[model samples]
Target: MASHSLSAVRKRRRRRAKTLLVMVGLLLLTGAGGYLALLNLEPSEAVMRERCTAVVGTETYDLNPDQASNAALIAGVALRRGLPPRAASIAIATAIQESGLRNLDYGDDAGPDSRGLFQQRPSQGWGTQAQVMDPIYAANAFYDGLLKVPGYTNMPITEAAQAVQISAFPEAYADHEPEARAFASALTGYSAASLDCMLRSAESPGDPSQVAAAAAAVFGNQSVVVNESTVTLQAVDRAGWATAQWAVANAKQLNLTSVSFGGLQWDRVGGWTSAETEPGTVTLNVAGAVVE
Candidate 1:
């Protein structure tokens, strides 16, 4: 009996150790810090935005600004790449399973090379240390692999993700499918005006150019106008929502005071209401910090 009990104890310890390794291994601070750079950006008396929500039919998913922001980027990248909506959902589901939509720089001890949002490994073909640590580059790399898989759209979300990421727990990705699909649909402009944000007022210097640049980074060929306090994205209703939601996601980071699209306005603490903008423009207003 003693011998059998000792063997069981050793087996449990090994399993625990493995779980620990994958669950919260070494913090790839460099990769994490760089990959999730946006998480640390935008310092101001800028009041943080409240929970951002994505509503699809009767289902709703509420996420923090950072998570919503990252999800927007993922969907934007997919659209920019000309991939289908299924691809975006798969990618979003994978990220949700791996990092809960927040870019992380943690990996298991046994395979400590993994880091960034996907928990990708440097040892694998993900990218160089610097590349994987950057969110744009990392997301692109993930797409690269995902695109290579044949019929990925037809596969189960978990199986599709497993094809791209040979994760130890291959089944984990399925659990996030519903939320991922909702977020992906909103961010992809498939479900127009389904994403909303509640912002708080703040006194922080803002940059229209920075928001423009970030939009361009995700959208690549999309046109954006940045002048003084206004950053406008000239798009039709659906695409405009994607741009408008992106602005809301990054509101705190950019000190955005208001985001408007198709005559729907979202200001700091103002929530969603009516606007009087042009018929085809999504505009964001950011104020210069009120110097005390």
Candidate 2:
């Protein structure tokens, strides 16, 4: 009777052991399946974070796509006017302090009629309300004010910005000097390959005509050629680098796949890399377009 009882006990123990192993295997399978599902459903954190950066020397400054776009436009205007990089730095600094590089349609209590990038007031002879709200007009208007300042380039950033803006907070412009200078240098073609944009895949097809128009708006009449999905501009040396970096800065909005110039190429997935291309030309390829 004792031997029979011991045999029954051993059988029960073996069944429990098998059940435990089965549960463990099932749990492992479920965990693996969940992981795969997560991978398919969501993008990694790194991939989702989109930003543009300007690395100057040992310091790096960052801006979101919107800010970068505005900064690029501001710098482009300076380039078109043949202003030095210092002028761009001061203009950008004023924009930073005034509207945070964004084109605002509203204004604060001090300047109730203020609008646009430099917070220029329509009442103060900056321009009409509609004109100040237009970024291109606003940028030109800001530069108009800036040019009136005697020896603006020789003045400190705060003093220069204050002279143009005539803001109540004069000292505040100094705070953005470093950031403004970095972006101005990169966008003005003084710093080569110093700007990079990490962005997600383009959401829609890009229009070549739009790209051509934007280039014309900022850089003025350029030798722009459009062939299928590619737009090539005749730019070289510092201007070439400037055009290339500007394309990178505006890539997110333009839905550009790649910008190549001066023996360097930039893409959304892999920042800037080396590639051989014709000299004295900057090539921009728009996204979601068939190359014919």
Of the candidates shown, which would achieve the greatest TM-score relative to the real structure? 2
Per-residue lDDT of 61-123 in model 2, one digit per residue for the tens?
999889999999999999999999999899888888889899999996548898988888888
- Give the range where candidate 1 is weakest over 10 consecutive residues by summed lDDT: 38-47
lDDT of 1 by residue, 1-292 (tens): 9999999999999999998877664455455555445343333313444788888889988888788888888888888888888988998888888877777777753277777778788888788777777888888999999988998889999988999998889888888999889988888878766787665454467888887888889887566777988888888866788778777777867788888888788876636787788778888888775643
Residue 188 in model 2: lDDT:
94
* Model 1: CA > 4 A from native: 1-49
TM-score of candidate 2 on Cα atoms, chains taken together: 0.84
RMSD of each: 14.8, 6.5
Candidate 2's C-alpha lDDT?
0.88
